[model samples]
Target: MTISATIDGQLVQWRDSKRYLWLMGAIIPLIPMAMWGLYALTGSTLSWYFGPFFVYVLIPTFDLLAGLDPNNPPEELIEAIEEDRYYRWVTYAFLPLQLVGLIWGAYLLGGGTLPGIEDPLTVVQKIGLATGLGMVAGIGINTAHELGHKKEHMERWFARVALAQTFYGHFYIEHNRGHHVRVATPEDPASSRLGETLWEFLPRTVSGSFKSAWGLEKKRLNRLGKGPVTLKNDLFNAWSFSVVLWGGLMIAFGWEILPYLVIQAVLGIFLLESVNYLEHYGMKRQRLESGRYERVSPAHSWNSNNIGTNVLLYHLQRHSDHHANPTRRYQALRDFKEAPVLPTGYAGMMVLTWIPQVWRKVMDKKVLDHYDGDVSLANVHPRTAHKYGASLEGAAA
Candidate 1:
């Protein structure tokens, strides 16, 4: 669709080239169904691992081939594109498909046989299927993230529904109120420090974010003269959705599917945290003389314009703009030229995070360059501060 507006006595028109491509995100939840079809046709267990293969291998390859898309809508057309109902409907479509896929996957995990298969799946194959489900759960969090940032009540409710799959409802609270406030600082657990491996970051972020979310909710309840344990607490209310969803599935599918549910949920959490580890790795906001950190700017976050990941993740790669304008619709997110650039799209970068040495080799230099070769200006890991000539005093200042 071409968005046209008359601004300051001049006619301006902008057509979003990737308008239809955004629909690809909604198709992600259908990967499990596609995997089942492939297995039915080929009778190969390898088809169960299709989710990880698609995300890690195929998406990265597509990113390399598709390259960057640096185009931003003209300034006057930003409001027109953001208000388009078509774009939001595409995101809303994902929730129903995601729920259906989870139910179907649970049935299969519980030994239910379908038209094509006469025999039940093996344990190994079941684990592969669980891993595939994990991919959907992980990406669903990204979908939730987009919806959660909006001011609409319906969209916020949809965000909680998306998070129910991973039982990560706390993220809706912490990300919006906690992380955004403390991002790129020592206090934010979601912000990864220099020399901190993905192995190190995963546990810290998972545990810390949970604690932070709980604290934030508790404080809000205290103001209302309520206790944190009540349903009125955002943490408890958000988590209630997961309890109903998972508990209902267990009743329908039997207790045997419990282990696989745990597996998928863990992997889903890991996948989301991996993205957090890379988004602001080594970036820091300097403290001022008044003992306050500077306001977040485009320089604080890493960004990419890779068309493949951009289409798949709803322009989430434009992290700088997201931080700058939290409520801006994904279609209206503009890339800032001043932001630090990633070597490739998020999918490719996530693979690098798995190998600590390789990740440091590829990214440490980029961090140093971003800070003009000053280690003190970066968020260096406390254990590795000396290695980077960064003192604790300098970091705190």
Candidate 2:
């Protein structure tokens, strides 16, 4: 069924199919619920691990089989799509479910009265459950990323609330203030360098991001003549909330729950870093003689038009457009023909990164090709410059 309406002096037809596309993101939350249901029915540990298995295994296979989505909405319909509240509501409605799944996973692993796992969860089961649930919580970060860019106050606050679930509240500050400004440069910890494996990138990103968040907050306070210790620091406010929430969970559940929360939060942060690593790996904005990098363009990021993951991640695969226009709504983000394209959706790419040799083999040539074999244009890792014959002396710092 299709509904037609007039807007901006143009006739807009909304088909039922197009109307419900945002519901695709609900798959992230549903995976955990399905895993728990299966575990309850069969009393199998395999069921508890099924969520991550489905995400990393089956989803990528299906995406490969389904192929890409080359279609884009007509230019006239973009305004209507951006204005549609259905897409935003789909994200908001899932926020509470993310928390519920986190709590559910905690209860099961923390030796609560959950029926699905009667025996005390083993160390391996706890880790497996935490990792599985962490991926689900990553959806909250994705939603937060979308909402944090909005101009509305409530949406921004809700984004922080979602971030607190994974104890990743500082992402709200660092990403917008630090990452966006320094993206595709050596100054941005979130942007992965060429030949940097996940192992090397994770430590730098995890530690550098928190430090960057603090520095960004301090700079903001200094500009306003407010001290660093004041409440005006959004990082302080957000992380304080996370600390209190984690403390409260410990009290409500048990000491055992502390490790569960910590482990899951680590996984959630890793999930974020993994996406960050892929978004601009080995891509750099050119530095003009004026001593400033050129404006970020579509060519600075990797884009994937894989239909399955695009819907699953709320069009994050069209990253080139998102970075180029930070305020553009997800539904309105466009794919650029000039942007470097990923060979597959993020899911498959993430799995490949687990084997560093495979990841380097596949991505190194692509990165070199993007710069037309000029290694200097790529963001070469400082230690690995010898491998690429790239000089960092004139590179944008």
Candidate 3:
């Protein structure tokens, strides 16, 4: 579908026009963390569940904003997605609050093994904290994820600090330099191989992500010929600092804290991988005779139009365009017609993903038979648009 370029005497993209959306994208994570802080005073069960759900299901969804495209958006009710996205940039305002929540949570929890395991109150507290810590991770880890890919260096630094919360220090290197370049292809270790279930996708994504991050650092070091020390090597520094800080924090707080911290890391990464799973699913690229892949297009990634997911995550559901133009920012990424479309948005799919058999059945055929393009570089690609209810695919070209 072609779009009208001229509006108000300017070629404004609908996605770019909605810069205000970005403001919502930026700081929503703090809402739950703040609630968790208030809950800290009460230690109520409702607070525990609400905190984890908001962090895991809520904040990460803010990422959808990063994938908005102005060419096609959710009808005229929302105009100028790009302008709306400019607002999302404001999310950094809550960064300090997120930090406070994490430190406070760490203070309340941390340490090797908990003593007095027989105490009911302590057991409940431990479980609650386990989930709450994951929520804490959602704040730091996911928040950094949104900023890490930006062209701005200060934004990238903010992302690094967020990664430090989960002790996943190498995300800046692995994600920007590694994942973006290799996504939707076998070259990207983060992309799930054919027939690989999400269960299997988990280990490969986590381990591969860390390894890639380290390798990124090594490549830089080799150019400079410096050891894996010095502040320049952020990953190494983060790893060392994380181990010491987490351990020291645990010792200082009490044994109850360590399990929760580790759990948070696992949960946050798991959420990250889940997004990875949805981003590529069955999409792939074309390999040219030169032994390099063809230029990326929006058709190379999967798209989901589910309004709930789109509204929540800031349009990250439109992933294909983001990968095609990594620096375009969420505002400029177009919601192209070539990408494959998902039946549901992220929230529903996230629920479906939990049941492997169902998720496989639901997604496999849609990916296999529906869309087609130059996939020798990697396999299936689909398109999704929020404005249309229809799910369409282009048979292999």
Candidate 4:
């Protein structure tokens, strides 16, 4: 059932499910809320694990059931979809749920009342509870990523607030200024190199990103004649918000609550990083004779059009369009035929990336295929290029 109309003088079409898209947004909050409710009613420690379970377990199963959606909206409607306030408001309305979920989960674990939860929960129980809350915090990063890219003033600030829930506020400065500029090149810390395992990439990215963010911020402040000591420094201000958040949790809950908050926030941060690793795993920009890399294009980042996960992620899997045009709102981002693609959505891929052998087995062939078997066209990490053996000569270049 498709219908067509004119909006602001542009043709618009409503597809089978697009008209009811707002309802899909509830999946973000409802799944975790339901899991928490189950834990409260039954007092089963195992119930606390359901949040991550639902994501890593159930979502991937559903992905198999729902299959891919290759139908992109008509090009003419891109502008109309962007102009529609419905999509923007859906992203905005999600902000409160993130804040409430964070606070509510903290209360559940911090000896606050619930039917079956005991005062002073076991350390094991606390960890389980934190794991669930961490999934919510990870989704907060997704929320921040969607909003932070917008040019609007208030939406940008709200992006920072959403990121602060996971103590990842610096993502605003680094992702926009640093990663976007250096992505797919050897210089970008966020992009995983050939043969690098998630374990190896994690520490490097986690530490390097902070360093990159600070350096980027410092340069900006320097241009304005400000220093780290000044409140005008954006990095300092963003991190200050995170510090205040951590301190607030300790005050509102207890000193004991601090550890759970820290663990949960780290889990959220790791989840975002894991996604980064897969997005550009073995790809790189070609360096030109003039000593500059070729301009970023759709080929640089991996794309996934898995319908169910794309909806859940607000179409973040459309990475090719995003890197090529950072300002394009998520709804307007399109999948390109030339873009490299993942075998599955992010949830399933996240699990695969943890096992280095399986990840390489699945993705290495795709990397070679994307560049027509020429390792020179790919970003082969110097240490592992020899294994691809035939292309080693050119790959070293």
* Cα lDDT of model 1 by residue, 1-397, tens digit: 7899999999999999999999999878998898899899999999999989999999999999998999999878888889999999989989999999999999999998887768788898889889988999999999999999999999999999999999999999999999999999989999999989999888889999999999999999999998888888898889899999999999999989999999999888988999999899999999899999999999999999999999989999999999999999999899999999999999999999999999999999999999999998999888888888889776632
Q: Write the per-residue lDDT of candidate 2 for residues 96-151, one digit (tens) a residue.
A: 77777776776766676556656777787677788787888776788899999998
- lDDT per prediction? 0.92, 0.82, 0.61, 0.80
Best by lDDT: 1
Question: Which has the better TM-score: candidate 1, or candidate 3?
Answer: 1
* Clashes per candidate (backbone, < 3 Å): 0, 0, 52, 0
Give lDDT: candidate 4, residue 205. Answer: 92
The TM-score obtained by model 3 is 0.75
TM-score per model over all chains: 0.98, 0.93, 0.75, 0.93
List, residue by residue over 182-205, the lDDT tens digit for candidate 4: 999878989998777899889989
Candidate 2 lDDT at 235 equals 82
Per-residue C-alpha lDDT of model 3 across residues 191-283, encoded as one tens digit per residue: 764445788778778888888888888788878988766678868766764676577766777766667778777766766677778778766
For residue 308, give model 2's deviation from the true position in Å: 1.7
Question: How close to the true structure is residue 335 of candidate 1, measured as C-alpha lDDT?
Answer: 94
Tell me how far the alpha carbon of residue 65 in candidate 4 is from the true structure, in angstroms, after superposition.
1.0
